[model samples]
Target: MHVVATAGHVDHGKSTLVRALTGMEPDRWDEEHRRGLTIDLGFAWTELPSAGTLAFVDVPGHHRFVPNMLAGVGPVPAVLFVVAADEGWMPQSAEHLDAAHALGVWHGLLAITRSDLADPAPAAAEALAEINETTLGDVAAIPVSAPTGSGLDDLVTALDDLAGRLPQPDVDAPVRLWVDRSFTIRGSGTVVTGTLPAGRLRVGDELEIPSLGRTAGVRALQCLGRPVTEAGAVARVAVNLRGVPADALHRGDAVLTPQRFRTSDVLDARLDRTGDDPLPQHLMLHIGSAAVTARVRPLGSDTVRLTLSGALPLRVGDRGLLREPGRHRVLGGTTVLDVAPPALTRRGAAAERARILSTLDGEPDEHSELRRRGIVRKDELKRMGVPVTSRPVAAGWVVDEKLWAELRSRLPDVVARWRQANPLETGPPVDVVRQQLDLPERSLVHALVSPPLAIRAGRVVRDDTAQVDHLPAPVAKAVDELRARLAAEPLVAPDATQLAELGLGRRELAAADRAGVLVRIGDGVVLLPESIDEAVRTLRTLSGPFTVSDARQAWGTTRRVAIPLLQYLDRHEITERLPDDRRQLR
Candidate 1:
């Protein structure tokens, strides 16, 4: 389907031409027909010989209704430029042409209407000259008289040829339906009408209003006044939305695919001004079917920062128009460079940002995108509609492959050096490894350190690091003597004084504990690792819940060693402690 919007001066027979072409009235409101002017947007569709089906968004041509005119044309890809033969080019004609140029509308057909009232040749020549000066640039012009029905066939043929030449809309793009009309049906609920130039809308699909932060389900879909299960791009569609009230919506509100777009009030963009004259600080921004007041901050010769009065769901590479508010003059065009732009807080920041934006001029590829963002999550990339052509370095994390390779190459050396600097530690902490590698995500560090190095006890360590078979000679001798003594009396634990006599200080005991040679039961107390097991085995022999005294007598140990030992068994859940200070097997 081909959707085209009409653009020209007021009362230039745009609606009449549409009615002639479609054999249906374009004006919907009674006020429009009574006043002989189009007050709101009118819709009409017709079958063309070469174009299959074509739809017309008959927009108001008056200067006072430019905003309404923009809403109709912003999403439509092609235009049916109307000019009255007697009127030639009027003020609104130039303004509409400016709007088309500002919005980057390139495909169009020029119709010199009311040709029966004047010489069509002269009017057609004048319109063609004006169009050649703008981006439309020498498009096909036809002379037609809607009332007399003269030259109407030629106009349809021209439209058909123009539509055939238009590029196909990308159906895979994200859906963003900028509603021009929204109203509630008595029994069916809320319905919204908009021109969908790209993407597909299907019944039961979920869509969101980003500005309102509300989501709704598509209850039904309609195209060309017929109910449809689904509709694709370049067609006028009406969607019945479930769970959304009519009052919560307005003309400029958009129904979009949630999480696919970012809403921002500030945008960094490249501006193509109509002239070299400096733009005013304040201007009206027209994007899609919405227009809002904005403050412009010049970044460089052709770069600008627009601070919008309200958030718009926009993405990088989207285009919009900037106009002098209330003046009916288009100041320039904007191509979005960055949505969610960085805040400028210091001097020369704008210049630095401009430099960054210069690098982001065109559509970015995968490698460049990764390099620009430094690090991005896979889910974030998917939500932003960015294609991931390469495999991710880690789960849920995407890094520049070149950067990852460089970082991975340095990991072994980094881990080895860290081990050398802190030999007492099990390994370098994960945070320390991340810092040394200058990586933003801990997952990246884990990915790079694995295989060659392994994570041990929450720290990254080399697999080849020497394992301690024995402690220093003096400590080993002390540990052996203590093990022998504990073997003879498994329940007995050395006190602080006895531990010092065996040359087992706090540091020595801690070393023995790590080596699994001894277990530290309490402050300044050490026991063989088997002693706790032996105590549990002995306690099981008792019939009922045993008291501390009963456990001491059974283990044949004094209260000093017995008390801490019983506490250790309770801590390990080998025995349960009762409120009455009794113990039992767990």
Candidate 2:
């Protein structure tokens, strides 16, 4: 299915041509038919020769309803540019053309209406020349009087050709349905209608209204007024929502795939002029079905920074139009360049930013994207419309190539400085490195480790350095003396007085424990690793459950060390304690 919008001046027979083509009234409101003019948007559809089902979004041609007309054509792709044979290219005709061309409507066919009133050849030739100057390069112009139906058959053929020329919609793309019309039904809750240019929508799909920070379940779907479980792109659709108020939604709101788009009020765009005039500082922004006031800051000759009045779900390469608020005309067309641009804080920042923006086109280039952002999550890069094909340095984290290299170069020095200040420990913890470097993920910190720097027991260290080398010389000597004394007497534990005499303070003892020189147990008690091994072996040889007193006497250690050691053995499952206060080796 395909959708086309009718564009022309007032009383140019746009609705008449649509009514003649579809046997259906394009106008929905009674006010439109009473005044014999289209006020708001109108919709009608019919099956064509080669085009399966083509829908028409008939817009008002009068300058007063220009905003309503823009809301209709802003989302539609192709157009049926209408011209009256008697009146050649009037004021509203030129404004309508400018609006359509600014919104980047490329596929279209011109219809010369009222052919019976005047010569059709002149009107057809002039409208085609104006259209070809924009993206709609060349198209067939068909002259037909809707009343007399002179060339209706030829116009149908041209419509089919235009439909075939339109690029196929991507069914797998993320859904972004701009709500053009939203109203409540008596039995069914709220319903919204919009043109689905790309992506698929299914019943019960959870969708988001980003600007409002709301989520709704799709209760039902309709395409061309037929109820269906699902609908695809390039067709008009109406959605029944489960959990929202009809009054909360408006023309500019969009129903989007949750987490798939970022709603931003500030964006950088590349502007292309529709004419030779300089773009104004303030304009109206028309995108999808929404129009909002925009304040523009010129970044370069063809680039701009727009601060929108409302947030919209935007991505790179999306096209929109900039129009003067008062004039019934379009100022220029815009292609989004960046949705997450950096802030300008310095006096010369805007100029420097323009120089950077000059290097970027509207297309999403991964290298240029990463160069500007330094690092970003894979999910956000996808939302920004950048394709990330390279392997992530960490889980769901991508770092720029040059930035990764710089991080690698800085790691060794960072570890060295931390170790120097903390002489008793190997290095700073991984989480500490993450905070110091302002990295988002711990896996990213691990990815920065290389040969010289290694993660040892959760702290970074030199791979070639021995564990004792991380301590000061005096602390190392103290640890060696304590180990020698424990080696002579297997179960003799040191008291705090003995430790202080050896100058092994709390930090020194902890450093020695980490280095595997000693194992700390109860308060003021320290033993060698081999001594614990020997004690475990001796306990198993006892036939019966032994009391703590019996073990203390056998090892000739004091009661203070023996009790805590027995409890530690029980905690580690090396021994089971009896109800009578005795212990047995497991």
Candidate 3:
């Protein structure tokens, strides 16, 4: 189905054209129809042989009502930018175009209405030239008169042709249904109407009211006024929710997939100065269906930091635009940097700029999305325009390549620091590394690190490189003393306490063992590999081969030392243990 919205200056025949094509009144409010002006969002649907079926959002064209228009146009991909032939392009018409472009609406057809009242050819040509300079310059424009139905068929054909060319909508991502209009039903609960960007919504589906922080169930679903069990992307649908209040929602609110989207107030964007003038530091920000005052801070050259009024969870790369209400000028466009921006006062300009630039320009395609949005859900990243890779172990996701590189470089540095500070320890502990890098523990081991380092079974190691640095003073002393002490009396190996006295504790000893500085011959008994070699030689020379008792007496030790020493020799394949507990070379 094709979803399109009507946008233009006030009283430009957008509503009249909608009524003529769909035979339904787009003006929902009694005051609007009585006044013959569209103050709120109006919904109508038409069926065309070429386009099949199309839903229309007649957005308010007045400057004061542009916010309402944006809410209606937010999720739709195509639009009917209506302009009266007599008026040509007015101030509000230009603002609507800017809003459409900022919201990322690319495909559209221009409808020059009221052609009977005035010649539309020249005006339509001028409007077309203005639009083409922007993203929608190549769109088809049809001149029509709603009062006389003049050129309506030609307009329908143009719309049908545009609809046919639209890329197929992805319904498999997270559900983001922006509420353009909401009301309460007597028997059912609150009902919301808007375009579905992606994901499927079915009866009994739980949707979270982001502005309300509450979850509601889908009691019933309708598409184009027909009852249905489910609705997919690119469809205009009305959802009856189970337990939400009509008062709790507004035009800017959204019903989204739960446990996935989050809210933030900080946005990073690229501002396009409308008339060759940079946007002032303070201006109003209009996005989706809501408008709020925002303070802008330009970074480097193209990026800007936006401090918003309320918490808005916007994920990285959410495309939006900025405008000043009093000025009615396009400040610039922006993608989300940090939805919840850090405290600006506490952060210096350079830091703030870096944070904003990082979100806007850095890592456009590497790490999975980092921002949590209120309207979009977990699965939406893959469903939207983002490119994600899917696997059996993990679902497909969006990532910023530059972020991955930064992480890869920094992660190993953190691990190296941890390992250097702890010589007696096995590589850096997983939890420690996770906290240092601010990365999830599940992917910690698998996370890429520069020099290709990794933690293997709690032992940190450079993938192909062995541990190389000399032991620290304390650990080094312990290693030297233990080796000297073992050589002086190979029969009696010192326990953990003995090592502790020589500047090593159990933890340090364990670390040394992992580092291969010392080997444990038995419980609480350590043997330097060098000492073990000497003991094995002595036993092998004595009587050619010896029993456990003979080796014990020859080494001047008890069965404890003799037994482990013989076992250690056997393990190294230096000797074989016989049935009578004797040791001999194979």
Candidate 4:
């Protein structure tokens, strides 16, 4: 299905033309029908010969309700611009044209309404010339009188041609349905209607309001006023939400897939000023059915930073309009460059940021964006409409693959240097590595050092340098002397004072123990590596359970050395400790 919104001055026969074409009343409110002026949005659909099914979103044309008009046309891709032959062009016509142009609506049909009252040729020519000045370019114009039904067939044919040329909606893209209407039904609890330009909505799919962070489920779905299990893009859909209240959702709110979009109040955009005048500090921003008051800060000649009063779910390349608050006249058009912009608080930061934004204006690819930002969340990239065509280097984080490769290549050397400086530590802490690499996320550092370097007990250690192989020559000779002395007198171990004189301190003794050259039984007591085996062999020669005194007599060692050895053997499961402090083989 294809949807098109109406645009023109008030009393230009926009509603009348829609009623004649679709044979359905476009005005839903009695006040509008009685006053013959559309104050709110109205909807109708018809079947065309060339386009199959087309939906019409009839919008109000009064200056007081221009916000309502924007709500109707912002999500719709095409427009049906109306003009009265007798009126030629009016003030509202120019404003509507400016709005349509700023919104990037290029596909349209021009209708010279009430042509029976005046010559249609001259008015059609003038409207075409006006449209040519804006982004609509040259559009097909038809002279039609709703009362007489003259030239209605040609208008339908022209619309059919436009619909056939409309671009196909991306059904696989993330859902961002702007709710233009929300109400409650008798049987169904809450129903919200909007144009689904992309993505799919199913009966049981979970959706969220980006600004509010409120979640709801699709209990039912409707498209073109008919019930359906699912609805695709480019169709007007009414979703019956299960959990959300009708009062919580407003006309400007959006329903989207959870986590696919983010709400942001600050935007970095490219602004094309309609005139040469400098923009005001405050203006009305219109985008995606939302009218917000925003503060504008010009970054460069064509770039700006907008701080909105409220958050909006916006993406890169989205078009919006900035209008004066009182006059509501469009000052310029905007193309979103960055939705999640950095805060410019440093000295000369705006100029530097503007320079950076100027580089991003050319539509950099995903890799270039990641490289510039150093790190980005997956959801943030999706919200910016960036395509993730390749796998990320880390989970939920995207880094420049080239940068990751360089960091990975240097990890081993970095770890080796860190170990050389801090030999007593097992490895460098994870935070230290992250700081050294100047990475924004710790997960990226872990990913880069995963295979060649391993994280053991929360420290980064290289696989090749994990073991302490060769100590200093002095420590190595001291370890050999200690081992030879323990081998000669297995039960007699050196004390701390004697070992300190030999230059074998606790650190060197621990290193020797790790290297399997000595066994540390207690504080300052070192034994040969095979001391446990020889002691166990000798203990078996004794009878049943033995006491600490019996083990000391059997090993010819003092009670201090004998007690810790029995405990170590018990810990290693070589012997069991009894309730009376006796030991038995296990």
lDDT leader: 2
Candidates sorted by TM-score, descending order?
2, 4, 1, 3
lDDT tens digits by residue: candidate 3, 1-586: 7888988859738888999999998887888878878898888999877768988988898887766776777778888899899889888888888887776678888989889989999889988988897767688889999899899999988888888888898788677777777889888878888888678899999988778878889999999999999888889899998878657777767788875565666666665555567558788776666667788877656667788886554555676677766766666566664443444465475565565464445233323343322112225543233344532121222234454466667876777787678765657766777577675443533545434565565655666554323356667666777777777776687766676678776666676677676777777677776777677677767875578888888778778777887787788787887777666887
User: What ranges in model 2 sit over 4 Å off?
Assistant: 275-279, 450-452, 514-516, 529-556, 563-586
How big is the positional error of residue 75 in model 4, measured in Å on the Cα after superposition? 0.5
Clashes of each: 0, 0, 22, 0
Model 1 Cα RMSD, 1 decimal: 4.3
Error of 4 at 568 (Å): 7.4
Candidate 2 residues 1-586, lDDT tens each? Answer: 8999998858639999999999888888888888988889999998989779999999999988888898899888899999999998888888888887788888888899999999999998898888888777788889999999999989998898888888989999999998889999988989999999999999999999886688999999999999999999988999999978769888889999988888889999988885668678889999998998899999888889999998899988888989886767788889999999889899999999899888887898788888888889888988887878867888888889999999888888888888788889878999988887888889998989988778867888787766777778999888888878888886878889999999998888887776666787766678888888888988877779999988998778888889888877888898999999998887
TM-score of 2: 0.93
TM-score of 4: 0.87
Cα TM-score per model = 0.84, 0.93, 0.69, 0.87
> Candidate 4: where are CA atoms >4 Å away?
361-364, 409-423, 450-457, 461-466, 469-495, 504-586
Lowest lDDT 10-residue stretch of candidate 3: 390-399
